[model samples]
Target: MFLRLSPRHGSRLLTRIYSAVAARRCPSCSAPLPTALPTCPSCSHIEPLPSTLSYHDIFGLPSVPNPFCVNTQTLKARFLQAQKICHPDAWSGKGKKEHDIAAAQSALLNKAYQTLLSPLQRANYILAQQGLSESETDRLGDTELIMEVMEAREELEEATSGEAVELARQRNRDRINRTQKILEKLIGERRWDDAKKAAVELKYWETIENAVKDLE
Candidate 1:
């Protein structure tokens, strides 16, 4: 278990789960790294960023008990701040190596921000961390769920008017919102199986939502 809380008592007890995470440091200045972000806040050194860092870790967000609940304001603020330091524009006229590293960092940071900002992407990311591949997320086996998505698609295709499209669009939006809530709870409880299924459900809903946009 990554983390388990005590039920009978308020106190917590951790079992034998040894983790030895190395301290991140700036090579040039040897300053303690505050976040897993690509650049050092103290010395403006661009360290090699680890791909293993969770999206939460990149932004310095809490990654325990309830990583699904994100404060968007906090995430946005941090993302913009990080981008200012590492954006390729800021690195121009510097050495090619510095510019290249900054460009890479900027790209990775942008991808991380978009993934966490979207509900479906965030849920799928958690499942990926728990041993599911990005491709496997769409291979849903729930017959009922498949049928529901098919029917929704058919209804949208059959929509002949803007009003009809809006109606179908609203229906899909509602479904997506509901699935987001389910994902939040299942992920918080570490119910990986249920969470994976819900992530797939959300994926279908998101596809429909996009299709709705095309219709409009």
Candidate 2:
């Protein structure tokens, strides 16, 4: 029979296992890297960020935890710390080659931070890891839900007053929050199919939010 692991224990075990893999040699000086992170703390060398590293790994977080559970304050601090070391401007005088590496490293970090910071994007990323990309998410089958969103969009088009826009925003926000909770449960349970559906629902809500604009 296969062994069963408690979620907490499993997370710790996975973190340790991944951390070992994450620590790599700095290609320049052969120094051990804390992660595949672009900067080498030992030699002040900057390397290209590896695509194989997960966004969570870049920030030294356990990859198995709910992606949305990351601490905002902690993530921000880690991002700032990484940026200070590998931002393109930091390597401007080093050499064109090093500066190019730093530029790519900085771009990757920004993408990772932005992905981890947004709940919808985080869900999409996690799902993508399971081979269920957002683009591949099956079309949502909830007819009534589709109708509700369509109605909301139509209402938004005619919305003239600040109060009306604020109300619409609140409704969209609530819908997004509920979908997030559903995603958390489905993902934590490893129900990839259902989690993908929830993520698709979230994407619709986010798109609607983007259409909301300042009242003229």
Query: Against the correct fold, how does model 2 do in TM-score?
Result: 0.79
- All models: lDDT? 0.77, 0.79
TM-score of each: 0.79, 0.79
Root mean square deviation (Cα) for candidate 2 = 5.5
| Candidate 1 lDDT tens digits, 14-98 | 1111011233555667787555454665766775565455678777777787888888899999899778878888878677898
Encode model 2's per-residue lDDT on 1-216: one tens digit a residue.
Answer: 977999766775665554455455666787876554747867778756544567888888656656656776778888888888788888888889988998887888899999988998898899898899878545668999899889878888878888888898889889988998998889888899989889988988888888885443
Residue runs of model 1 more than 4 Å from their true location after superposition: 1-43
Write down the lDDT that model 1 would get: 0.77
Top candidate (lDDT): 2
Per-candidate total of colliding backbone pairs? 0, 0
Residue range with the least summed lDDT across 10 consecutive positions in model 1: 11-20
